[model samples]
Target: MPARTSRMTLGRLLGLSRENNRARDWFFEDSGNLLPHHRHHELNPSIPPLEVTKIALRLRHLIEECVPCELEESLITQAHSRVITREVVLAAKEAGGEEYRSCVVFALLVCSRWFKRQAHLELWDATLHNVRSTACEVIAKAIIEGEEDMSYLLHTVLLHRFSILVNGKPTPPANAVEKAVDLHALRVICSSGYQKCLQYLWRGWLVQDEDDPTVFVDYRGRDDQRYIVHLDPDRLRAPVYQNIARLLFSFIYLALYTMSINSVNPNGEFDAAEILLFLFTLGFICDEFTKFWKAGYHILSFWSAFNGVLYAVLTVSFVCRMIGLSYPIGHELRHSYDSLSYNFLAFAAPMFWIRLLLYLDSFRFFGAMLVVLKVMMKESIIFFALLAVMVVGFLQAFIGLDLAEDLKTDEIWFIIQAMANSVMQSPEFDGFEKFAPPFGILLYYVFTFIVMVILLNILIALYGSAYSDIYENADDEYMALFAQKTMEFVRAPDENVYIAPFNLVEIGVIVLFSWWLPKRQYEFVNDVVMAILYSPLLLIAAYFESRKAGEIRRNRSRGEDDDDTVEEWEQIEDQIDFEAEGWTKRCAAVKANVETDPAVIEVRKLMDEVAELKLMIAELKKGMDGANGKKKDDVKKGSEGDGEDS
Candidate 1:
């Protein structure tokens, strides 16, 4: 189709009808728990050649219109019937567009409503896996793009559904059976969705080339072509880049620290700029430590060690500076103690290199090599430490021999050199037993062989094994890493403004002033001044970014090929069965939660009591019947006796 005609035709494919107009008033974003809002009105609008979109849109609207208490099974089934149909999915694949993708995702939320309907978890997961695994990219692309129509239609329905499941569980139930059913269903959906999301993440990452000239699906979703030109992160160009703001801030912190002490007062009293910069560095490092702790960093990761080491160095330097500052100028302690801070600061300069590598962690080769090195280092360090002690002992022993008579340095240095396979003129024991016995040379050679051949080979083996495991899981590991980074980058709402001094200023400006100001005035300042003043740089960048984004969308509308053929390596057939086990585990977990739920426990107790009461009532009725029969028998026997007497 020609560009003009494609626009003329597809543009008109959807328009604001009276039906959708009503839905526009109270549009629900991606929170699966629907609040009762204008429920008296309902609409089902359709755009042809894309029935899936229509179905998904209506279904989403339906979900928002009714809460779980009021949600009708018929409505759920109806929505699901439309979603399960091939019309939407096929439309998405054929059109190769976001709109079609959006429809399929919308349709998929029917699973949330139908959660109570499906009970057998493993079977349900298997069914969903087999059905949706192939279309992982389609679903992921929808999430990645995350485009909302002007009407606020097509939000992240699956994520919304997850929120609903998590929050809806603890509520007091109107019906225990219904609640249990829903709980089981929600758990199934959540578990299945997580596995499905992993597949989605994998499929999305599978196609990315990092070097793609056009664009790659990243968390920022900004046009990389324009954004890469000026990589001034935390400035105008920063927000447009994906997952680089914190990294950029780290570099900025390094720069501030380096520049702080370059020119100190001749009198040894640090200038105000120097003091200010040190304070900034201290604040930044503390924040980094806080973020590090909050992120739950493992000691096993090289970055964790790097961050910890940097923070420690900065802390020691800060303490020295503070101690020096405490003393009066021209005092002997001031200059002398201040130099200690400078000394530590100099040591920390090398850490900036490690920070750079950590920032570029998304690079595959860089990351893979780091993984290999980390494994090698972690495994060998302890062993080498022990070997160092033994080697020192041997060297001490060797120094006592006549062979060490010409040694210049300590025996420990010669031992270290020999063990490191370095050239050394000393420790030349010619014709054994010059000062020591022949047994000495024999022991030394034995130790050398063990250290050189055995330990070296062991270290090699450990590195090789670690590398192999990492290599085997390279794709999954990278995808998981990328996904986590992206999620973390976007997870915090304040990350945009949380850079050093600005964050401190925000406390006073936002917390103190806002409390003193009237509600309307404060909100006005927040909405207008603070938003614009702090973020205009981002806003301008966004405008230019949107222009580029518009071009990409136009290209997409013209039917550019976005779908990548599944490579042999990227095929997920093997993963589905593997995930099937995970799904089963999740099923067991959900079943356990449902069984142990307090509400269910109480319901069980009541039922048990009711059964006992019924049993007691039945026994009492049986006794009464027996008494009535005895009275009748007594009267009959008396009548017979009277007749006999007559």
Candidate 2:
């Protein structure tokens, strides 16, 4: 039978069987071969048997009349061969094994074919599961092979599925089927693959050989269409790089964790030492490539560099410990000396680099170079105070004025000797442990407190103030732009002359007030003073600006007689009265107009009504006092009876 004819017959049989048990039995057992003959006969006999034979005969007659096909001798055999069967499906499921991964591949092929043949099939759940499982396997292999293209596609698909799932809260269950797939398991299986893919993609661009342009082209253009249409390279690359950085940052955290544990028991293995080293190396490379420094350099770079140094030191110490345990020197004394030298390097390397990086990035360095000349010119007193503190500290340290009393102990002696060896061998940290005298100690403390702490705070405050002023001015500028555009469109006079400047001034005042005052005082000051100062200014400005614009519009609409002009004037006065009435009514109707928050509106209405009642009571008290005074005067004049009569 033709495929279409067979599908139509199947649909009709299912539809007709919905109302009749005998027809359903005939279709499921004899016509479709969904059940074996022995089981069917046994089940049928046990149950109150349906007249399935008669129903099958009727279905056969219908098919023969309506469907253009040769009548088959055995419908079960024809159905079994033509459509998906229980045995074929069971075999397919069984074929899916760890060693072969046959089930995943077969499922993908079957699902694709099913979708193509029956486009409206309600098989999204099954299809999604098959796709997810297949994708997991493919991603795992791709990760092992360092294939970025596959990894990118997998990540994109995951993100898309996540978005769909999140957006499907109120949607139908079928819409969220893709989101319900086991994403966590997939991610775990594909993590190594993603890492490898990221590594390849990051390094691929750097390996462009000037002698071979084709390699560069191939590297970039392998799936250009897919990248352009499906993925945002910047968005994808940024997160991946950040992930790499975070992984590197974890090394420092791991070291800290190890250190904390070691503080309790120093002999345990530092399991994170190698991991720290690996992460630091990866982070450094990513940081260099990403140019994150261009955006904001201070805290981020400093922290990254500091952590990198700390991890590097820990890694070196671990290496030294491993070597010390594994290998022995020629003599006992020599071995001890060598061990001390390695230990000294481990500590000194990190300290030296960390201090050097800080010194290089110091504000004093910038100040001396005259890089911030404008700041120096404007804030000379603050700058000089900071510089003097730094200079005093430097001189004291250089002169060795803060020497500490020597602690005479075997450990101290050993440490000193180890440092001497390190200095001799490494040519680094020549005078690292030398203690400065008392004056130097005082100077250092003063400099740290005065130059670093105080000066830094002042600079922060200055920058904050400047940022506020700029932001407020920017808002005013945007308002000006809006006003200019509105005027241009309406062909009106510069009515903004009155209103725009006042609005700008009001915004400026608010910004300045916020800057000077603490947050707690804002409501008090803004409530009492802001309305008094700004309300009248805004109202006056708006009145003049509106009048100016109106006059310009009226002039443009000239060339009418006195009667028409008088009519226009009357209309204008009517509009003015109407607006005045509207404003009064609107003040009364505000509680009804605002629907955003019912609770807030109710509270505001209560407050307003209370204020109105208080004002009305005050006015009534004043009128009663005036009337009482007049009655008292009449009584004093002996006209109390006449006044009462009147």
List all candidate RMSDs to the true structure. Answer: 21.7, 39.3
- Candidate 2 lowest-lDDT run of ten: 1-10
Candidate 2 lDDT over 1-646, as tens digits, reads 0001001112222243434644544453353232122211111111111222222233223222322333232321232322223443333333333332212221222233332333234455444333323332332233233323432222221111111112323221110112212122222223443333233333221112223211111122111222111111111112222233333344454464345333322232234543444344444444433334433552244345665565465556545555554554454544654455345444544453343332222223322222233233445566557666665545434344323344332234433353334323332232333443444344435544554566656766765665455454443333222222222211111111112112343355567787888744543443333334334433443344334333433543563311123554566664466565687677676655442356777898999999999999999999999999999897787776778789
With a 3 Å backbone cut-off (N, CA, C), the pairs that clash in candidate 1 are 115-185
Native-vs-model 1 lDDT? 0.46
CA RMSD (A), model 1: 21.7
lDDT per residue, candidate 1, 1-646, as tens digits?
A: 0001000111112243434533432242212112211211122122232354345344434333232233333322332232323454344333325433323443434334343233245564544432332223333233333333311221122221111222334222111112212232222222333334333333222111123211112222322233322122223212224334456566766676667657655454566656665666666565665566655553235665677788788778778878988988888988887888888877887886667776676676666666566566887886677677767776666666634565544454544555456212133344333335675567567666667667667767877887898787665455444444443442332323445544555555677667689854554343343334445344455456546544544444544322224468756765666455697777667774432547877899999999999999999999999999999999999999999999
Q: Where does model 2 exceed 4 Å of error?
A: 1-304, 315-319, 322-326, 329-390, 393-646
User: Model-by-model lDDT, in order?
Assistant: 0.46, 0.35
- The TM-scores, one per candidate, come to 0.45, 0.22
Model 1 TM-score on a 0 to 1 scale: 0.45
Over 4 Å off in model 1, which ranges?
A: 1-242, 261-266, 271-273, 289-301, 326-332, 363-450, 464-477, 492-497, 514-540, 552-646
